[model samples]
Each structure stands twice: as C-alpha cells, then as structure tokens.
Target chain A: MKRRWRQLIYLLTATAAALFMFLPAAAETPVEKGLAIAREADARDTGFRDSTVNLLMILRNRHGQESIRRMRIRTLEVEGDGDKILNIFDSPRDVRGTALLTYTHKFGDDDQWLYLPALKRVKRISSRNKSGSFMGSEFAYEDIASQEVEKYTYKWIRDEVYDGLECFVIERYPLDRKNSGYRRQMIWIDKKEYRTLKVDYYDRKDSLLKTLTLTGYRKYNNRFWRASGMNMVNHQNGKSTRLEFSDYRFGVGLRDSDFSRNSLKRVR
Target chain B: MGRPAYASAAVPLALVLLLVFFVSRSQACDLSGHASVEGRFFFRDALFPGQEGNSASVALQPEFYHGRRDGSGLTFTPFARFDSADPERSRFDIRELNYLMLGDHWELTVGISRVFWGVTEFVHLADIINQTDYVEDMDGEDKLGQPMIHLSMPRDWGVVDMFVLPYFRERTFPGEKGRLRTQPVVDTDRAVYESAAKEYHVDLALRYSHTAGIWDFGIYYFRGTGREPDFLLSADSSGKPVLVPFYVQIGQTGLDVQAVLGNWLFKLESIYRTSRDRNFFAGAGGFEYSMVNAASSGVDAGLIAEWAYDERGEDASTPFDNDVVLGIRLALNDAAGTEALIGISRDLDGGDSMLSLESGRRIGEAWKIALDAFFVIGSSEGDALHALRADDNVQVRLSYYF
Candidate 1:
C-alpha cells in the first residue's frame, strides 16, 4: 500500500508540472498579453476555408421607425491576407440582384466592386469609405469587413465577469486612422472560448459613440464560434441596428472564380 | 442564307421561357421588381408644333428568376409603360429573358439580354450593344433588351466576352403629341436601312476586359447596324412633310478604362467608328473624388469633373460633344438612404449650358420617391440640344418595390 501511494504521488506531480508549463507566463506585459490572445483567436479560426450566411438587418431610429434589409454573404478564406467576400442583396426589391465583391488586404485598402442589375454594369468602387454606413445601416463597412490581427494595436485593460462568463477586457486602437471610423475600441472577450462578447466604440474625438453586444453564439465545425445576432446602439443619435444571422455553412466549397469581378455580374 | 434572317421582337422571350420551363424541376421561382408612377411638369411652353405640356406615366418592371442546383439559372424581366401625353410611350418591351449556364471557367447566356459597357457620368461612348429606349426618358439611359447568345471565358490574365446578336430592336421615338418630339415626327413605318436584312441583321461583338491591381479596362469591337438613326427630310404617304429614320452599317472599336486610387477614381471612355457614310471619333474622360463621412457627419460628398469631345463638334447629334460637365454627388448615409446628384454642363463651342438634378429618398421599407430636373439655356440653331430649348422639365416619381 505504501509503494502504491508513492507511485500515485509521482504521477500527480508529473501531471501538475506539465500543466504548469502550459500556463501563460507571468512576465507578459499587458500589450503582449493582448496581442497573444488576439493571435490565438485568429489562429484558431484559420482553416474554415469558406462560409456562407443569410443575414437580416433591422435598423431603428430614435423615433421608433424601423427599416429592414436582407442579404446573403459568401466568404472565402485566404492564407496570408484578408478574406474575399461577396454580398448579395435579396430584398428592397429594387436592389434584389445587386451585389458587391470585396477583396480585403492585410495592410492596405481593400478592393471593391459594385454591380447594378438594371444597367447590367459592374463598377469598381473606392474602399476608403470604410467608415461609411453599409446599406444605410448603423453598421459601418469596417465593422463587417474581415478582421485581421494586423489592423490594430492592442492593450489588456483588465479582467471581468460579463454575463456570467469570465472575460478579458482589452483596448484596441485603430491603425488606419485615415479611414477607420473609430479612434479606439474596448472589447470584452470570453476567456474560455476567445469569443468577443461586447465592444465599446469610441469615435475619432475619443468620445464614446456606440456599444455592440454579441449573443447566441454557436460552435461551427466544432472549432469556430459565431454569434447568431449582433446589436449595435449609437449613444449619440439613439439609433440602433440588429444583425441576425442564420443558415450558416462552414467549409463550403466556394471556388476562387466565384469571387472574381466576372462573378459579380452573375449574382442573381 | 440562314433562312432569310427573320426578326420578331416578342417571339424570343416566349421561346426562352418555354425551353427553361421544361428543364426546370427542383427550384422555387422568385418574382421581384418595382412599379412606379411619375408626373412631369414643363417649366416653359412647348417649342414644336405638335408638342404638348405636362404628362403622367406609370411604369412596371417585373423580374422572374429560377436557379437550379447545377449552377444554371433562368431569368425573365418584362417592362411596360403607359403615358397620358404620348401614345408612342405607351408600349411594352421584353427587357430580358435569358438562360444562364455556368461552368468552371466559362459562362453562357442565351436569349434576350442587355449588356452595358462604359465608364462615364453623362454619356457612355463605348456602349453600343442594345438599342436605346428613347421614348422612355430624355436621359437616353434606358435600353431594350436584344436577342443574343453570349459566351464568356474568364482567365488569369483577362476575360473574353463574345456575343452573337440575332435580332435588332428599333429605337423608340416620342409620338406626335409628345413634348420632346421633333416637329414633323419620325415615320418609323417607312424606315430604311443600309442592309437589306433590316431588323434581322445578325450583329457580332467581342470584348476583352482585365482588372489589374488598381486598373480596370475593356477593349471591344462591334460589327453591326448602328442604333443611331439619321433622319432624312421627306414626305409621308399623304404628301405631308415627315422625317424618315434611316440606319447604316458600321464597325466600331471602343475602349473604357478606370483607375481606383483610394478616394479618387479616374475614368475614360472613347469610341472610333467607320461607317459607309462617314467616320468619326467620340470620347469622354473624368475624375470623381469622394470625401467620406466628412465633418464628423454621416454624409459623403463626391466632386466630379468631365470633358466630352467629338470630332463632329457642333455638328454632332449628341449634346455631350465639346462640353465640360461639373457635378457634385451627396449621400446622407442615413436609414432613409437619401442621395442627390447635381450637374451643370457647358457647351464649349455653342456656349450654351445645361443643368440636371437627380435626388431620391427611401420612404418606409419598400417605397421611394425621386425628383429629377433638366434645364438647358442659350441653345443655338447648330447645337445638338437646340430642338428642346423650351422643354425644360421636372419629374417626380414614387416607386413601390416588391
């Protein structure tokens, strides 16, 4: 019985030592910690290859008037840069067959194209308007675009419990000041899943402008987590927008040609 | 050759639908489009003898689309209009009815389709595929779909589009009582063509387009009967003075280029043509610079400047010849999606000026209102816009989408 106790203690010590080695180092700075967390989140989402989603956007003004816009999104992942995305409008019948194609980059401005079905024309549009509202919604183009780790500089603010989940509060400053609408964003990410739960957007004047809450997250492919709904409320104007997502297909076989400018005309 | 080259405008759309109906089995078809009612008010008295003032019109454009799981689809769009002031404007058109099949590196579209090619604000010099629906609007931005078999191949370097246009649709003109019509009106029933095939002319067109880095360019060649008609002063069957529309055969080579540099966009469109009667050159170039979210407001303002030049100069049939246009575009970026564009064009040689405004706002969910105005001043006898000096008009349209 004594021999068995000694063997069990040895086994427990070896397991504890191995777990300790795996823990994050205590000497990490706030900036380093924030960056590492972001990198890990990004790395964990690398191999989704392609995805398709159906979305509904509800926009409401302070007067209680509401508007609706429906669309479909198809995305293809890239290895070293930003992803390629296709946006096809399904409602507001005038723009039903209209589509937009975007090829985002890691460092520079993205390339975009807009197709107008009435004219049967494809127009190359400028992407410097990242701060402009998308489809007249409260959500800006920068908010929906591919999120790359290189787009911002990060700093860990603190740790907190949000909605019964332990989270890491981090502050991220926009690197592309010329185009980005925000000066900085405060984010709360779930510690267990690296999923972002909330964000506070500060305008260029460094004033609190909007707050976004993400909810109804579901695991995709047993690896990636996606929010089923996102709520954005503007503090300055009392306008809010809710984006509801559904019918998600991950790792869908989308070819590169489907994201080309030629394909922009075929999004009927 | 080719069974007499017959042409019937309404037959092909029906044929396309019949063919696709038998092939479609597993998809739900969708119906979508817009219906609009508009009122136009003329600021001045009509200039021509038969011209009248103030008009009301209703327009409907409906689209039906069916897609299969095999990457093939069928689409049908039909347009109809009724004008209170002009009989010619009360007409129907098969705007588009086509079957589209997609392949790995290629795509094919059969039946009636509309294709547009150009990069300009006021005029698209390089676009010549479909005949203009001139009776629809004064802006000449509307087109009637053409019967075609289009094949496109996408490659790493560029895209090649080839078209086999089987039939030609005649250009619509304002009726005798229309405000924008010529004095004697065009006698379409007695129209003549340089080719004996007339509306049965089988035109061919091909274009090679490339999107490189920040530049998008298309070079094209078109061999066909020209859409623009030169009117010959003649007499009607009853011996009254009339204008007979005449079409000519022509070969055109055109190029359109655009460069996107951040907030700035540069555009150019040029066309060179060789016809049995004459050869000419027409071109336009411009730039648009946008200021997004300016002054911390959710507003975008874009400044535009363009110059149009034609070898025919004052003798050119279009008003864009030898003119400079300056414009501003604004968007509110609000939930209502409000936008406006205002432009003023000055003729260099004739020294006349024209002003235009197009503004729109979305109402609730599926309704919208638009206001458009056009004004011309000091139009000389030799100027292209001389025919419509007293036809300055403002139009208000309310639309419902479904």
Candidate 2:
C-alpha cells in the first residue's frame, strides 16, 4: 500500500513539471505577445478617415538656444496600406510655403515629394533616408511616419509602471536592417489606452541614441486620442526637438484625389 | 518719354486699386512680404572691359492673398530688384498675379504666373514656359512670369493641364558691363519677332502628368513663340557688330520621368523642338544615390551623374551638348541648414570642362550666407565656353531675409 501511494505522488509531480515546461510555448511566446500588443494598439487607432492639425516645432541646441517653426499637417489613413501625409510650413519666414508630401506603403519603399515655393516646382525625393533628420530637426524621418506593424519584428519585454501608469515594454527590431539606423527600439505603452508614453531608440551599434516622450493626451470625438506634445531628446548630441500639436480636426472627408500632385500646387 | 511716364504712373495706379480692393474685403485678405539685401563680390578681376569687381543688390517681394477655404482665391506677388552694377539686371516682375478657382475635379487660373517642368538636374530641357531671367543667375533657374489662362483637370489616369498664353514679354539681357557675355554685345532694342503679331501672339501648351508607384511621368506639348532667341549678328546704331535677338515660333514636345528605387533616383528630361530655323532633339539623363546618415554621423551624401546630349552637337545653342556631369552633394543635417554641392561638367567633343561649387548656410534667424565658384579649363577655340574661359571666379553673397 505504501509503494502504490509513493508511485501516485511521483506521477503527479512529473505531470506538474511537464505542464510548467510546455504552458508558455503553447499559450504565447514573447514574439507572439509583442505582436499581439502591437496589433491591438494599431487596431484601436484605426478608422480615422482623415485629420488636419497645426504643429509648432521648437528646436533646442546644446546651449539651450531655441528656434520655433510653425506648420500644418494633413493626414489620411489608408484602410489596408499606410498613410498619406502632407506637411506645409507657415513660419520662420525663410521656409514658409514649403510643403512635403509623403505616401507610405506597407512593404516597399515610400514616395515623397517636396514643393519649394521659391522655385515654384515639385521635386521627387528619395525616401530611403529614413534615419536622416527631418528639416534639420532631431526627429528622424522614420520617427514621424506612421509605424506600420510589418516594418519591424517584436519581442515582448517585461512590464513596468511608468509615470504612475501600468505599461507594457516591448522591443522592436527593424526588418530593413541595412537601411534603418536603429538596431532596436523599446516602446512603453500604457495598459489602459494602449497609448505610447515613451520610446527609447537604440542606434546600429546597440547604443541608446535618443528617447522620445509623449504627453498631454487629449481625447477627440470621444473615441480618438491625440497627444498634444512630443519631445525627442538626442542622447549623444544633447539636442532636442519638441512638437506641440493643436487645432486638430478629424473626419474632414478628404479623398484620395486631394492627395495628388496636382493638389500640391493648389494647397493653401 | 511718354511711354516711360505712362508705365511709371500705371504701377502706382494699379497698386492703389489693389489696395482698395483688399481694404474693401479686409476679412478675407491676408498680406505678407519679405525684403532682402544681397551683396555679390567677385574674387577675380573683371572679365569684361566694362564689368565691375563687385555689386550690391536689394530685392522686395510682397505677396497678397484673398481667398476662401474652398480653393477660390486671388494672389498677387510683386517682385522688384535693384542692382548697382548693371541697370539691365534691375527690374520689376509680377511673379504671380492670378485668380484661381477650384472645382470638384477641375481648376482654372487666370493671370500672370510661373510654370516649371523638368526632371533632370543639370539642364531643364522640358522647361520652356517662362523666359530665362539670365541676369538674375547663370544657372537658368530664374524666370520671368508669363501671362496665361490655365485649366487643369484631374482624372483617374492622369492630370491634364492646358494653358493659353497671351501677350508675351521680351527677354531681358545683361548689359555690356556684365561679366558673362558673348564677344558681341546683344542689342535688345533691335529685337525681332518672327510672327507679325510680335508680343501679341497667342501661345498654347498642353501637359499630362501621372504617378504610378515608384515612377512619375509627364508629357507636355507646347506650340508658341520660342523662349530662346536666335542670335543674328548685325550692325548696331553705333556701327559695331551686335547680336540681335530674333524670336521664332516653334512647337516642342517634352517628356520628363523620374523613378525612385531604394536610395537611388533616376531622372530624365527629353525634348524635341521644331521651328522654321531648325529641328532638333535634346535630352538629359541622370541618377543620384544617397547614403543616409553616413557612418552614423548625422550627415547625408549623394553622388550624382548625368549625361546631356543634343543632336546639333557643336552648333547647339547652350554648352550642355554632349556633356557629362558628375557631382556630389552634402547635407550637414544641422540646425543651421548647411548644404554644399560640387559639380564638374566635361565636354566630350572638345575636352573643355567646367567646375562649379556652391555652399550655403544660415546664420542666426534671418540671415544666410552663400558662396559660389566657377572654373573652366582647356576651352578650345571652337568650344562654346571659349569666350568665358577667362571668367573663372568666385562670389560671396550675404542675404537678409525679411
């Protein structure tokens, strides 16, 4: 009777160990968890047909000298692909009336065109410089673009509390390793709204290069959440760029025709 | 004297009328302007007999717009420049004085404006709408605004633009005191027009542009007075050999295409021009590849190469016939907006070559400094640049915006 009881206990212990070993693999891996989180975040942000917003960009140097630039942005979200964005500068006098138009794709290279008011011409630009600073600002071109899910592969990091909000930390590695300047990026998303609160960018050398923090969340249309301010700080250069967004208008009924090159000349 | 007096009085009268119109619709009108002072100093001695060593200039451009959100608007941009070295270089232009109305799929614009069309970097073979304002710069980028009525219609396949240009303006020429000039001075007063209508000739242009994925393509057809004037050597009133500009009517078919792939951009501009004097084809094709954030230093560098060809070869008008150009561009991606470019063009026929360097950076908030250098080597007697071979020099320009 004693031997039979010991054998039953051993069988229970072995089964418990086996379940512990296979549970995480069968339920969810780190990659699966990360992708699921990203998918959820992206799904929540969809259905915004079009939006227009006014932006004020403040650039500060190491010496704390600041220069302000005012611009307006119009964006249209494509159902299955990426987004189309138009940025028009209004102030700083020298760059006034300059406009940049971009059409991003899900898989391949994006398209960009720049309109110079002084020249009264539109120039097609190469969009492979995703890591280059945008208009001499600390924000790289890739940073301002819509973050497509397929552009990067993800790994779920541990969760942590940031700014008194429970957040999930995820690390993403760019799929286009050769073109991207960043090796990986760590993103902190809040648990309640899945809104991105902070991001740490690592350069190709796997060194921390910049940190981007977003704050001042304002809900619009009772469904869409827009950040009022975004601050990017370069760790190596001690320079920073801050974007303050205001006057957001959504669902303006903008069509694909409005984003054509012909409209670029007619944009006010 | 009568014409000058009338012209001088007409400017102020028009200004007063515009001001009155804006003041009457104060709620819809917005006024903005910028004034700039520039100085150009030559590093070498004067190339021509009457040329100066340095010059100073001031320019004022004021833009006024009255419009609504629905794309109905009137815009007026009046530009004026005053140069100390050459009176011919100083002039006034209505860069854009147009009334635009936009509909669901069509747009109409009436009045004077500027239009540019091209894809290549070295030469703008497809750009023919506006006459080159040569006195403003040697790169042929500056243009004299054209008076026209334009209509554009966008369709699923492409966008079509039609232009009806009336009342042509004569091209301005540099004075004898200017540095870059031909051996014989150009006599603008003796300008000849092939059409009996002269400046009243009606010109027309049609263009179609489309973008498909990575490629952008455009085809344009223009039937009008040629912007480039044929030089006829004649005796001036001073009994000296002078070049008379003879404007001729011509038909031009132009094609411009650009393909963006990865970090490379390929551009091409080709044009076929037919006129009473001659029929010829010219083209420029180039490619540029950029290395983004080279070595992770926050700098971008682009390497460019282009080939320019003309059927007329040595008899071609400009210096870009059968030439190869290689250039490099550097962007410092800094707060000061620093950019530098260097290019060298080699003539395949005569071994003559030209090298150019341009660099610019902004200072403080509203100030900009630019440096430009041009050098020529081994310009044979039959080469087009032989006349200006000795004119190699550098110039420094400082400008204050607004």
Candidate 3:
C-alpha cells in the first residue's frame, strides 16, 4: 500500500511538469518566438552528413569590369558543432592547386590551414579575420562561413510579404560585437519552408552596408533546401559579387580523416 | 639547387612530351603555369673582377597534369630561364616530373619532386629534403627538384612519409658575373665529397606529422650527404682564390611545431645534425599576431618576430648563427589583392643588419606585379653579409599566368 501511494504521487508530479512546460506557447515573448523559429530552421537543416559543390564567382566593379573565379567546396556536418570545410581554387592558373581547410566550432574561433602549392607546405592560420575579404571578392569570410544560430541574438520584428511569399523579418545582433563588422542584420525568412530569402547587413556605425539575396531554391532528397545562386552587393563600395553553384552532391561519404591536415596537400 | 649543368631545355623536352601523351588519354588533363619577366637593379658598383650593374631575365614554368579524383596522377613541370647578364642564371630544370599512385591508406610517388619542411618564418632550420636553388633566390625559399621514391601512409595517430633519394643534387651558386657573387666566387666544378660515392650517394629520410587541437607538429630523421657544404679555400688553375664546396656525410633529426590561438600564431623549428667533422644544434622560433580591421579600416596588419640560433656561432656555414628578425605585414582588402611585408634582420654577434621589403599586387585576372628591395645597414669584412653590402638591389617582376 505504501509503494503504490508513492508511485501515484510521482506520476501526478510528472504530468504537472509536462503541462506547465508545453502549455505556454501563447505567453512567449518576441525573443522566445524568434529563437523558436531559428531553432526550427536549424532543425530542418540537420542530418545532411556531407555535401560537395562546384561554384563560379563573378565579380564586377562600378566601371562594369568583370572577373571570374572557379572553385570547389566540400563540407561535412558535425553533430553538436559547426562544420568542416575544404575549399580549393581551380582558376587563375597561378593558385590552381592551393587549398584551405577549416574546422568551425559553434563557439570560439575556427581552425584554419592554408596549403601553398609552390612549397608543398601547410600553414596554420588564424580565423579572427572573419571580416576580411575572401579571394578579393565582395564576400567577407564571415559571410561564407557556416551560420550557427548561437552566433547571434534575435528578436521578431514583424510578419510581412516578400516576393509574393509570407515572410518573417527578424532583427539579429552578433554576439561578438567587438569583432564583428556588422552592428546588426535584418533577415527575411520564408514561413512555409523556413528558408532564408534575404539579409541586410548594417555596419558598425548602424548604417546599411551590404545586402545578400538567395534565389532558385531547390529541394534535395525531398527534404533539404539549397539555394542555387547568391548575390552580394556592397552599398558602401560600388562592387558586387555573384556566385553560381553547380554539381551539388550530397552524402558523398566523407569522414573526419578526410579533413585532416595531411589531406590538404593531396587535394589535386 | 640543381646546377646549371642542364644548360638547355632540349635535354628534357622529349621526356616531358612522352609523359604528357600518355596521361591525357583517360580524363582530366590540366595545362597551366606562369611566365615572368624580371629586372634587377643594383645600388652600388661592382666589387669584384667580373662586373655587374643591372640584369634582366625571362622565366617560364609550365605544368601539365592528368589525374583521377580518387586514383593515380601524372604531373610534369618544366622550368627554363634566359638571363641577360649572368650565364649561371640561364638554366633549365624539371621541377616536378612524377607519377603518384594513391591507395586507401597510402600514397606513392616516383620521380623528381620538391619537398618542403619547416614552420618558422624568418629562418628555416629543419628543411633538408631538397637542395636550395641559390641562384634563383638568395632568401633560400626556392628549392631544386629532388629525385626520390616517396611513400606516405596516413593513420589516426599521424602521417608518415618515407623517402629514398637515389641521386644527390648539387646546390646552385651564382657565377662570377652575377651581382651577388662573393669576391672569389664558388667553384662549382671543384666540389668534393667525403663519401666515395660522391653525387651518386643514396639518402634516406623519414618524417611523421600530427595535429592535436590547435597544435601541429612534425618530427623527421635524415641520413645522407649534408645539403649545406663546408668550404675549402683553394687556388684555381689561373692562380685565383676560389671556394671549393666539401660535402660531408651527416645524420640529422628535426622537429617543427606550430600553435594557433585566436589571432596569435607561434612556431618553432629545430635540428640536431651530427657529421663526421662535428655536431651542432640549430633552431628557429617565432610568433605572429594579426589585427584585422585595424582602426576600423579594411586593412589588416600583422606583427612578426623571430630568432635563429646555431651552436657553431661565427663558424657556421650559413648566416643566422645568432640573429633576430622583426617584420610587419599589411594586407589591403581590395579587389586587386594588394599586400606588403617589411622585415629587418640583425646579427646578434657581429652587429650586421639588413632591411627588406617585399610587396605584390594582382592585376585583372591573369597578371601580377611583385617588387622586392634589400639594403644592408652595417657589415664588416669578417661578417657573412659583408660580401652582400655592395649588392643592395631592387627587383621587379611581372608575371602572366595561363
């Protein structure tokens, strides 16, 4: 009789705790709603394992002079972490065999290594220069890095219609204010598929600096969404960069050993 | 540092063509490289008999490669240069002509290739795979292709690379007419060797490299004829003094390490060499700190400092017995990829000092411009850099890539 009474008390407490935690959806603040939405978007992107893509970057100045760069990128998703990436240049002839390997973390600085083809040597590089230009293009290193929701604090601004689709406009501020090039960013996320449609970057002076747009969304494995192209326009400088991606392959069976430092020298 | 014995490109032209024909039949053939035109101007008058003031050179290095993404590969790179002043600088080489076979856990390479090892910036104390191409660059950054059979295995603990070098390459030296040549010049034709096998001596090397967290390290052992030779003063047939290079058998072990923490990078390279003549330990250590977006500007700035030490002191074959180097690097985050680095080296024992500046910028899609200037601040006759005091020069190179 005594054991049965104790078990009844425990069951009653568990049910009460579950109800208290699940029944407060309407009472959530704007911050909580924004975080929830970010989490949902992140959850949808999980389980990709690995992916590879070939891309062409076209850079143009105000004078309309254009240049082109070709490269290949391989990425492996890590559980409870950021990602591991390998970037190899394929054009300009001078740096054709140069490669860069990066291991990003959800927190703290990323680990990066550069493989110099002429010397057949690898150099350990600092990733603190996230705001620096990448390959002389309009895209900053931070813009190309894997985005983790924990890097920023978000608040829901409002619901709006963008490009004939219902969207949620959220204001996000970088957690690393001292080092980030941007003061805040406004993100437009579509509601139906939870896809990021566009973003407006504000400089440290709280003024508009750059805008990025994603287009031609494609579904892979009938689950994951990927943008076929990206355009980044720098407002402060009259320069823009457009990235066209091709040959997207998912689940290529990549392992941690493939991202090792020794692998950098062999990525012909 | 293969000698100018390969006086003409015609020697290796047929061999390169034969390999190129065989590799392109399957798939993924790549043809690329760069052509450069360089001009060098000296600030002081010539100090030796064979005089020099200004020189110009044209160089071409073209690479042909064919490979499968996950299988074997064939690469051939031929280098040639034509100089207006120094005959020794007019040379030809096969920088890389190799066949690489890849397996699930190991890779093998057969033929000539370049191998670099070290982590320090100012000085390299642990790099011993390939001989230095001294005529190409006094900074010792350029290396001659070494003929070897290399095997590499990658495991969870570390990566192991073993090399069997069947042929020895002699270090190249500037000729009597070269601007940077010493007072008496080096007599390459009179080089001596302690080993009876001489240039045909076999060499063996093994290395293991690993990365743990933010640290990457390498350990290596080499047994062979030493790359850097001791000099024996001798008189030429014309009754002129000349330096005869004397190669000794040696065994060397090296270690290199690097650590990255935030914006700071620390590096170290050291070697302990034992030869029939003597034994010595040499080391180079340094640190670099980068400041991105300094003062709210897009330009990145980096501060670097390093120290090199050798147990032989003033009697060392190479300079840097005890020296310190300080440098600053600037990168402008622009479309043209503008960057520059200024450095200064000071000899702790002899008070010899020098300052150098190297800068480069990209032009459009397939062209680049590079500039380098060197100045000697102080030197004496007994110092190693004394021979270079009057050789202060500025060089400009324009490269076109395809």
Candidate 3 regions with alpha-carbon error over 4 angstroms: A1-23, B1-18
**Model 1 chain B worst lDDT run, 10 consecutive residues:** B1-10
Stretches off by above 4 angstroms in model 2 are A1-26, B1-20
What ordering of candidates by DockQ runs from best to worst?
2, 3, 1
Candidate 1: misplaced stretches above 4 Å?
A1-27, B1-26
Candidate with best DockQ: 2
TM-scores for all candidates? Answer: 0.93, 0.94, 0.94
Give interface RMSD, per candidate: 1.3, 1.4, 1.6
Q: Better model by DockQ, 2 or 3? A: 2
lDDT of 1 at A12: 100
Better of 2 and 3 by lDDT: 3
Residue B342 alpha-carbon offset, candidate 2, angstroms:
2.0
Question: Between candidates 1 and 2, which one is better according to lDDT?
Answer: 1
**Residue-wise lDDT of candidate 3 within B1-402, one digit each (tens)?**
235343344644565677767764755887789999999999999888886789999999998888877747788888999989888889888788888888788889987888889988768789999998888988788888887899999998989999999878788888888987777888888899999998789999999998888899999999999999888899888989988888999999999999988789999999999998799999999999999878867788899999999999988867688999999999886667689999999999899999899898889778999999988899987888888889999999999988
Q: After superposition, how far is residue B275 of candidate 2 from its true place, in Å?
A: 0.9
What is candidate 3's CAPRI-style docking category based on DockQ? Answer: medium
Backbone clash total for model 1 is 0
